[model samples]
Target: MSSEPTHQNIHTFDQATALQPAGPHHWKGQPGRLYWNMVGPFGGTTAATLLHAVLLHPERIGEPAALTVNYAAPLADLPFVLEARPLRTNRSSQHWLLLMTQVDTEGQTITVASGTAVTALRRGTWAGSELPHPPVTPAENLSPRPPTAGLAWSERYDLRLLDGDLPTAWDGAHADDSLTRLWIQDLPPRPIDFLSLAAMSDMFYPRIWRRRALRTPAGTVSMTVYFHADQAALAAAGSGPLLGEARGQEYRHGFFDQRAQLWSADGTIMTTTHQLVYFRD
Candidate 1:
């Protein structure tokens, strides 16, 4: 055997999952890699960490059925506390409220973001769906997107754009084709879990960026997701480069609504998500 040592790259998803418990209701967060956005940590990762805080809570019950996160303020790249409190709990479901806060030199805690999640004990029953996964080119046939020059967070995912380009280069061939499809996976490929899946669900860039090729100031003000898959379904996907689609339905009054869906490689609808974004002309 050759005398060479081997190194394994860890997915950034796991790096963010390494939150340390600080107390009964709080955990510490650490920023990693190109996880930062134009102002702070990527919203997806921030949401994932918040959900993670709930998962680590001893009082948590069942799996996540729905989650809503509000980007109240920008997050600094310092140690922050994730406070997850169960709003209520019953035999079948539980609701939790989450907050991300930072302590200042004066020993005061500051709230940066807030979220709520619902976890429920799913039961076996007849399932039916009228929604179908959108047809797209198989991910294996498409090459990975070239990394965007300045966006560090973009490098964390292997995204294959099937429908639209960045607002920078709009061919204008299909102005009405606002639908954006991407085959995305962790940079190094990690198993699909609630945490990773939650982050992937928010991986779509702003819908306005694809609809109107303008460099307008836009951000997701609030996001919500409803999960349809359970732990077994997630495990069946293994380490997947999930197929995702997003599009804008309406835009007015400095805000727009976008809908997104994440499907497993086998065409299972894993999650359905929607977000309200704030935009300025």
Candidate 2:
């Protein structure tokens, strides 16, 4: 473990997702109330925490290339254990397996989440983006989303919606589609980094509620994120709000899938994500 002292001015996000080395390939973390959701801590923070472990690992290699997190169960508002193991290492890529476990009231250790990640040494090469950035009003001209009553995590982000705001009334109205485009950034304004990028990937609200206009029960079951931006690209983004777009592909048998992308102000695709979600009738 690095013996560096913690910065006194650490952001709440870093504090909430903070990890302390416990042993080889193991770390301890606790949920913060600031990122709490209805059932537990925000899924985005949880995902970021998992990635944080790998990022801090002494044996870690390269930057993050892809990450897949599976929410196995709700994590209680208590201390938890995170285990990140480098399963394999290659010249240009590394593979990792992650697990978050907590002790239940019954004294049994159970997994709350699991994940796999790939980090790779990127090489300079010719690259191109096929999808052009969508036309949307600048974030400066739009007002930030009001604080959501009960969901503390909503207050952590400055969201300026360009389309598909949450349903004003739960009248069971059905929209033609569930497409949301918005500009979002950390409320206190932090620099763009891989950890924050990972968290933002799961920031969108459940698509089912937006589609049916009903406050149905829904939560993400699994999420996968592909990192497209390199360190230079992220540095160019700075702390500016990213243009986020998301839409539901299908809803069937009490489940649905959401696809989302994050684009920098300069039109570089920072990350793309897809998630499977479960909803109740």
Best by TM-score: 2
Q: How many angstroms is residue 148 displaced in model 1 relative to the true structure, after the best TM-score fit?
A: 1.1
TM-score of every model? 0.91, 0.96
TM-score for predicted model 1 compared with the true structure: 0.91
lDDT to native, each model? 0.82, 0.91
Q: Which one is best on lDDT?
A: 2
Residue-by-residue lDDT tens digits, candidate 1, 1-281? 11222234555666755699898888997766457778777888888888898888999899999999998877777788788999999999999999888865677788878889999999999988766777789888998888777677777778988887576665433366468888988876777888877888888887776777766788889989898989999998887878898888999999998899899988898889999999997
Candidate 2 per-residue C-alpha lDDT over 132-191 given as tens digits, one digit per residue, 9 for 90 to 100: 899889888999989789988887888999999999999999998999999988877788
Question: Model 2: runs farther than 4 Å from truth?
Answer: 1-8
Model 2: weakest 10-residue lDDT segment is: 1-10
